[model samples]
Target: MSATTLLLVTLGLALASFAYGRSRAYSVARLGGGVRSMHSLPSHYGMMVALWCALPALAIIVGWKLFEPSVVSGFLQDYIPQSVYEAGEKSVELYKNDIGNLVDSQAIADIQDPDKKIAAQQLASMRHISSLALFVLALAAAIAGATLALKRIKADTRARHNVEKIVQFFLISCASIAILTTLGIVLSVLFESLRFFQEVSIIEFITGTTWSPQTAIRADQVGSSGSFGAVPLFLGTMLISFIAMVVAVPFGLMSAIYLAEYASRPVRSICKPLLEILAGIPTVVYGFFAALTVAPALRSFGATLGLSVSSESALAAGAVMGIMIIPFVSSLSDDVITAVPQSMRDGSYGLGATKSETIRKVVIPAALPGIVGGVLLAVSRAIGETMIVVMAAGLAANLTANPLEAVTTVTVQIVTLLTGDQEFDSAKTLAAFALGLMLFVVTLCLNVIALHVVRKYREQYE
Candidate 1:
């Protein structure tokens, strides 16, 4: 049987076990006059039996599923011809894939080779038997666990405690998975970056102004020697992000304040959702809007003002990016502002302070931490955005502080490095991971700051 079929059967048994366990507990309780004779409720006893019946069977089935492919592949070794089996690892992998294809697409009538046809048939028979054995084992485990649990159920049984322990274990497992996944990502990026640093000088990568990443095919090859300077990319990223923040923070924060503090309930209900709808629109659409609409409009506006702005400028991208991140800031800041105690506002009013003065002094200070956290989150969103930047900001790695100049960001460079039919062994490819590591560190710092702000302020208020 397949894993799906086996799991369904096990679930059915667990349901049956739950009902039987509950009935048995109720019968035992009746013998002692009432349910007060039992240590826990009949429902608790039922849940305990269900947990035992499901957990062991689920664990066995999951273990079988995890190792099934490898075990079947190991079995296929006996059927491999000596000539193909003696080949290198790549050949062996190819041979294994061919076996899977043959099983899927070729029947006894379709196979021209008599040996392969016989081997495929044998492989099919073995897998079927293995699946059947797994199904039987899972069902047996479920039955045994349910029987043991039901037999243990009595007046003195701590069914609630056992259930709590199982649930606690599950929660711990989920947390561990998230933590281990993050650790794995950090280590992988570190290893790849270390490989990159071995090929290029870390000092040159960080300090040099030029950003060409080409590596020569041969030592004597002309025009292939590349500069690995990341200064321009970093500067460009900072410039664009600065512009985005300048646009986003003021507008978003002001909008949040207005919506939360001043606006009528009906207006708040209608406008807030409408404003947040900007966040739901795809970034690709924003990219199109930035490229076709915003960039051209900016260029034309600059011309009317007798100012020079590139066709694809940082200002255009940043402005569009800021608009994209508005909901992130406004939505979060609005929540934080609304969460401020109404009593504080009332107290301010009693002190002869106007509504604006109360908001500026008491309410804002009270909610500063959460608002700061929200802005930090918006900053992160702006930094991580790719499509809008790619479309509005042209891919010229110019080292400029001017918002009117076209510049490419670190994200754009990373994308450039990874895309296309390129060899992974070169410094060009490895540089992407190194950039990734740098980006990870920057984002990590932002997260740390946001946490610190929230924690420090939260302590004072709570």
Candidate 2:
């Protein structure tokens, strides 16, 4: 049977087991004192039985799926010609791939080679036998588990405790999967970055000024030696992010304060949703707006002021990015500010303080930690943005702080470096991993700072 079919069958059995277990629990309870003498509720007994029926069957299905391919491949070895094996491991792997492809494409009847034809037929039969065996075994296991659980459903059984333990184990397994996935990503990047540093010095990559990453494949090719300095990328990223924050913080914070503390109910209901619509818009749409509308407007404005502004400049992208992130700051800050206790504001009023004084002294201080968290989230969003930068801020890695000049960011460069069919052993390709490692470190530092700030204010307020 297919895995999905088997799963449906298992679930059907579990449902049946649940109904039977609940009926049995009621009977056992009636024999005592109408569920008062039972150790656990009827629902708990039902849940325990359903879990017993499902868990063992699901485990067998999962284990079968995981190792089925290797087992089948091992069986295919007997049908292969000895000469194919004598060729080498690569040839053997190629032979296996061809067999797998033929099987998957259902072209077994069209097989021209005599040996391959026999092998394909045998492979099909083996898979069918394996699947039939799995179906039978899963059902048997489910039946056995349900029977054992039903027998144990006495008045003294602790069904609730057993169910809770099963749920706890499942939750722990999920958390472990997430942690291991993150660890794997970090270790993979770190290893590749170490390879890159071997080819290009870490000192030169970090400290040098110019930023060109085109390395020629051949010795006779031009620019065989590439420059890997990341200073320009870092400066461009910081300049754009700084501009974005400058535009976002004051506006977002003010809007939040007004909506939370001053605006009437009707106005707040209408304006808050309208403002948050900016966040719902796709980033590509924002990029298009930045490139077509914002960048051109900035250039025209700068021209009127007798200033030279590139068609694609940092200011345009940053401004648009800031506009895009406004909802993040506004919505979060408004929630935190609105959550402040009413009695504290009343106390300020009792002390003859004005509305502004109460907000500045009592409300803002109490909500400072949450406000910092919101701003930190906005900062991270600005730093990680790629579409706006790529569209409005042209990919020229010039190391300048001027907002009117064209520049690129680390993410854009990472995308550029890994864009085409390039050899992974080259410095040009591996530089992406090095850039990723640096970006990770920078984000980590930001998180640490945010944590410290949150802890400080939380202690003072709470």
Candidate 3:
């Protein structure tokens, strides 16, 4: 049997076990006069039985999967010719790979080499044996566990307690997995960035004004030494992000405030979802709009004003990016603003304050923390954005504050560097990791500042 088929059979058994467990609990309760005499609910007893039935079988399946490959490989090694082994481990590995592929493709009959055909046949036989063994073992384990749990389903059994403990352990395991996964990602990025820094000076990467990352493969080639300066990337990222924030924050916040405080219920209902529809539009579409429409419009307008504007300028990208993020800010801010206690607004009104005054002094203060969080999220979204920038803002690492000029962001360059076949050992490829590390640091700092602001305001509001 296949693993998936076996898994379905196990689950089918568990379902049957649940019904039997519940019936057993009812029978035990009848012996004690009524279900009220039981120590736990019938559902809890059923859940306990289901857990017992599935857990042991699942454990066996997991352990089998982990060890099956190595065990099969070890058994297959005996079939390899002595000459192939003497050729070295690499040659033996290649021979094994060939046999495995033949088995997978079911092409062992087509093989001309007698030894390889025999090896492939053996591999197929072993895989069949392994699957059959697993199916039998898992079913046996499930039946045995369910029978044991069903026998113990007495009126006085603490089935609820056991089920709760199992659930708690599962939740804790999930939390630990998430934390460990994050730690692993950070460590991997840090190690790769360290390798990159070994090749290029960290100071030069951070502070140098030029941002060329092209290193020639040959020593005698022109421009063989590449500049790893990241200042231009940093400035471009900040300039575009700043422009986006300027466009998003005011418009989004004002729209949120009007929706939460001033608009009638009908108007708010109609407008809110319409406003949020902006978020549903894909970023690539926004990129197209910026590149094909907004950028050209800006260029024409600039020409009328006797000013030079690049066809792909940061302003066009930033403006479209801002429009894309408006819904994020508006939706979040609206929720928070609406969540502010009505009693606070009533108190402000009792003090003879107008609606606008009460909103400005009382409602907005209470909602400021959430608004700040929303803005921070939008800013991070802007910084990490790639498609919109790539399509609208041309990839020129120019160190200029002018939004009218073409520029590139750290994310764009990182994507550019890692797009094709790259040697990880080279500084050019490793630079992507270094850039990723810097982006992580920047985002972490933003989170810290947002937290500080949130905590300070939250204390007063609370």
Question: Candidate 2, which segments miss by more than 4 Å at Cα?
Answer: 82-88, 218-222
Residue 319's lDDT in candidate 3: 94
lDDT per residue as tens, model 1, 110-221: 8777667767777787788889889888888999999999998899899989988999999999999999999999999999999999989999999999998988655566
**Tens digits of lDDT, candidate 2, 168-245:** 999999999999999999999999999999999999999989988888876678874889999999999999999999
**Cα deviation in Å at residue 368, candidate 1?**
1.5
Deviation of model 3 at 16, angstroms: 1.1
Candidate 1 clashing pairs, residues 3+ apart or interchain: none
**Model 1 bad stretches (over 4 Å):** 106-108, 217-223
Question: lDDT value for candidate 1?
Answer: 0.89
List pairs with backbone clashes in candidate 3. Answer: none
TM-score of each: 0.95, 0.95, 0.95
Alpha-carbon lDDT, every model: 0.89, 0.93, 0.92
For model 2, give the 10-residue run with minimal summed lDDT.
453-462
Q: Number of backbone collisions per candidate, in order?
A: 0, 0, 0
Candidate 3, residue 137: how far the Cα is off, in Å = 0.9
